[model samples]
Target: MENAYKEIEKGYLNMELLRFTTAGSVDDGKSTLIGRLLYDSKAIFEDQMEAIERASVGKGEEEVNLALLTDGLKAEREQGITIDVAYRYFATPKRKFIIADTPGHVQYTRNMVTGASTANAALILIDARNGVIEQTKRHSFIASLLQIPHLIICINKMDLVEFKQERYEEIKKEFSKFAPKLAIKDIRFLPISAKLGDNVVDKSKNTPWYEGPTLMYLLENLHIGGDNNFLDARFPVQYVVRPQSDKYHDFRGYAGRISSGVFKTGDEVKVYPSGFTSKVKGIHFGDKALKQAFPPQSVTITLEDDIDISRGDIIIKKNDTPKIEQDIDLMVCWFNERPLQIRGKYAVKHTTNDVRCMIKDIEYKIDVNSLEKDYDDKVVKMNDICRISIRTTKSLYFDPYTRNRETGSLVLIDESTNETVAAGMII
Candidate 1:
């Protein structure tokens, strides 16, 4: 299949990046768990470790707090609470990882949605001492609603609960009740002590009755390559590259990342809005032509015929076009401090297209903790996920979020300030 963005991308198509988010209630040791993963995986540099040690010394702590490694903000360091989503990067021989450690506080629930929006797996921390709290269910709901493939329930602070098998079972039992209502397909629960380093990297000597793969083992072995939508091909054109230089004067290229499915060098393709068909002449990364392209890859595609294609136009297979509708129903998480207005006019960003949209009607408000849909509440507040309908000025071609996150997901930006106010997933 012809991918339209193969002619204008950086040539080398060699690296892979995995985005995973850490979530849980406040004091659930999310930051500490991330530090443990980085430390145990031997991904931390000496300078980074030195800074952590110095920070520990300043706090007069006996041992360096591993959570300090990801909590880079001054307010988070001073208040001992994560205020914003903190991202950390590290790599192992098996895979490269990007950790989006989001705040566990309820008010910052919007941050968790932002972090987990693109995550393949979610690391949910549960404090053994408190068992399953209200916040536990909230994060789980968000992960499922976002259509994340895997959920790892890390029962943290196991040492404080004496590593008792019964206590762990109790918490697990409570969570199992609510798991049925979620969209999660695979769920695994583990007992861990983020503070004592139990069952995080290597197996623990403390939990003698428990035996399972360590957190690192699960992350390294989880099959995530097949997590993308293989049936639908959606590549939103980011830019049209045409160099006026001597050698490449006639070169025309469409540059963008392949959001889903696969693209081959000699397949026929179509461009949206204009509904023009073209054949794939050559698929190039920078200079070398590729045999094919897949999800999460950024490449430049050169077509056989020059058709009028520009930014915001999606390149997709002709027969497998998405449902184009002017109105859509979605679950939206309001992220703005300013209250959401009824029948408000905001710019809706779907894929690469931005159109003026109006909030038609709120179907219902979802209780994140209970996973219950409350239709009686029509008003959407900050951090609330309400099923809503939006009518756009132009029709948008989209698939369900479960099928294609790249095309099915969108954001609502305030028209005046141009700030993102909500994130939505098509239902």
Candidate 2:
């Protein structure tokens, strides 16, 4: 038991996390593919499997419907569709995975944007029989707009197309023509049958002509180490930690997740908005002291100088400071039903900074289908994406969304209702 426990702990420590989102048209097998991936990987518990089995029988399914595993909501199960973003977690020996199964309907495009916002990779499913359709282009455009590092185009439902290599090749060729227009760095194509478990977790004999890594293999082995912006060091202070206990009264640390780049002890740093200079005295992760901290790590840092630093302040290398500007240009994806009001005041949240901003102008709206910019149609509505300018009440420290996703993104909240109205990516 001791040996087994040690082996398990070692495996857990060595595992890398991969966050991916799945998207396709309605009935294109997004949920089913996730369910199949989980089931074949042996990640599903026996009791959970039995419950799904019972539900499948109640629905009069001839065979157990794997899609039922993810359609957990009563409305989703009744309508036979995914309405919201359904997140699922599973782990293989090689890596741990977080799957965001986004809705496929055109109305839920906002949900798709929210789901794929922080993803490292995107799994775009194309129905083999229908080939590349409009929804496929929409999702692909959003994936590129969000700057997801990897794109895996899974041509699904090979059983319907009789597992024909020609069909897969045709769809691949069609999508390749459109893929060049996007800004995605890496794009790969694969053929799979989610229902029959072909080329998902294991190699399928049905596709003898196709030779490629399985979906699971591609996800587990994809290179994501270079996806983060490591050159520009940025640390947004989320909280100012001060120990009140008598044991450690002198503790003053700024705690936040590293948004980008690297921070190390003894490095010269500057506080944003105040322009105060300081040296890093220490970096702490819980009770353990770390020599350095990088992106996505929540570590408490102590500076040599006791400056007036607080929440919403950014700390960075003195030489590589980000642009501190109040007027910003960005691409906005409107998420509310009410049309965006010109010159409207909305609360903007970026990183750890909060400020109110007003819409100055709508430069153009890009049609996701054709990638055309329309300067005439400025009325932005739900799911309408456009490029606009905004002037903030206070200066913001940010980079282009293409440069650093963590520092380059923000959300606009409706001041009256406190609802998030839109998500913006800085240009």
Candidate 3:
């Protein structure tokens, strides 16, 4: 039994994971969509189904309230609203998935940002009856800002709209009018009834006019292999491993996750800030030696020359390097309740490097609803998105968030309380 469990765990870890986030206005059936996905995929356990069934019965619901599968919080279940980011995991034969069901309330915009930060795709649901609204635009803008590769506009509650093709087109047209303003590379539309499980996991007969792939099909087959920046190599040093044993006394390895591009044995590399150049001696994954490594892969790298390297340093091709600067422009999303003060000092974290920084100036606040820049409003509050300037005490290595999401993003921690005050995308 222990061996069987270990085999199962190994198989799961080997499966490719697709991380996606769901965002929609209140009552747009975001929870129900996730519940349906888990249910139809047979990912739910018998005990969980029974618990949801019992909860439905206790609430005097005629049918099982599928939303209860994700609305796990007491207050959320009672209020029939999502208050925080609810994460769900499931797998089909094709691939494994991690779903972040973010709250639709405007006040929880920070939560939505957090959920979609690492997502490969953003599933934006819209009420078929209501067409496109301000919240829809806001979420779409956030997805664009975060540089999510795929944008899926699920027109939910199509059953309520009688599955009219014209209504679907109308909403599609409305969204298309606003989509060009975003940085979204790929956008697809689907008519789905999350409650009825139509066009979600299977094709809907009611919508014979639609010829697009179902939600599940698109998710499983979306080509996301080219999403990372493969041209610029970046490896941030996280730890230095030195096995001081007699058997292998000369093993010096720098352990870190490959941020972008590729690295191979015998490649010429340089350590950041120090400008120490060296040749790649070897790369290893635990006890196994590897010839090459790429983005998202965690490995230990060895250098030909023993240079002074430590945590917070970066390794890259000698000729290919990121910008090292003290002053940087950033598109920042304020997450704290207290407004961001100009010239306020805070701890800035970029990649593995942490240093002190001050808010140099506020350029303008973005109006998510109208997609306008309010140059007059410099006061950034909670959930406010704005472009600002920051000056750090020391130079840091970075790329534009548009160029590399892994290396371009950062967070500010308040010195007084150590709370994450804002999330920034290096401009």
TM-score (C-alpha) between model 2 and the true structure:
0.97
Whole-model lDDT for model 1 versus the true structure? 0.86
What C-alpha lDDT, on a 0 to 100 scale, does residue 389 get in candidate 2? 99
Alpha-carbon local distance difference test for all models? 0.86, 0.92, 0.91
Listed per candidate, the RMSD to the true structure in angstroms reads 5.6, 1.4, 2.6
Compared with the true structure, the alpha-carbon lDDT of candidate 3 equals 0.91
The weakest ten consecutive residues by lDDT in model 3 span 7-16
Mark the regions of model 2 whose C-alpha exceeds 4 Å error after superposition. none
| Superposition error at 243 for model 1 (Å) | 1.8
Error of 1 at 52 (Å): 3.5
**In candidate 2, what are the lDDT values of residues 1-427, reduced to their tens digit?**
9998998888878999999998864488877788888877788999998998999899888888778888779998899877888889999988999988888777887988998898999999998999999889999999999999999999999999999999999999999998888999799999999888899989989998887899999999999999999999999999999998898798899999999999999999999999999999999999999999998899999999888999999999889989899999999999998899999999999999999999999999988778889989979999899999999999999999999999999999999999999999999
Cα lDDT tens digits, model 3, 1-427, are 9998897887766677899999875589887888888988888889999999999999999998878888889998898787788889988766899998888777888988999899999999999999999999999999999999999999999999999999999999999998999999899999999988889988999999999999999988888888888988999999999999998798889999999999999999999878999999999998999999998999999999988898999999989979999999999999998899899999998998889998999999998778899999888999999999999999989999999998999999999989999999999
What are the models' TM-scores?
0.92, 0.97, 0.95
| lDDT for each residue of candidate 1 in 103-194, tens digit (9 for 90 to 100) | 88778889999999989899999989988888989999899889989999999999998889999999999999889988989899999988
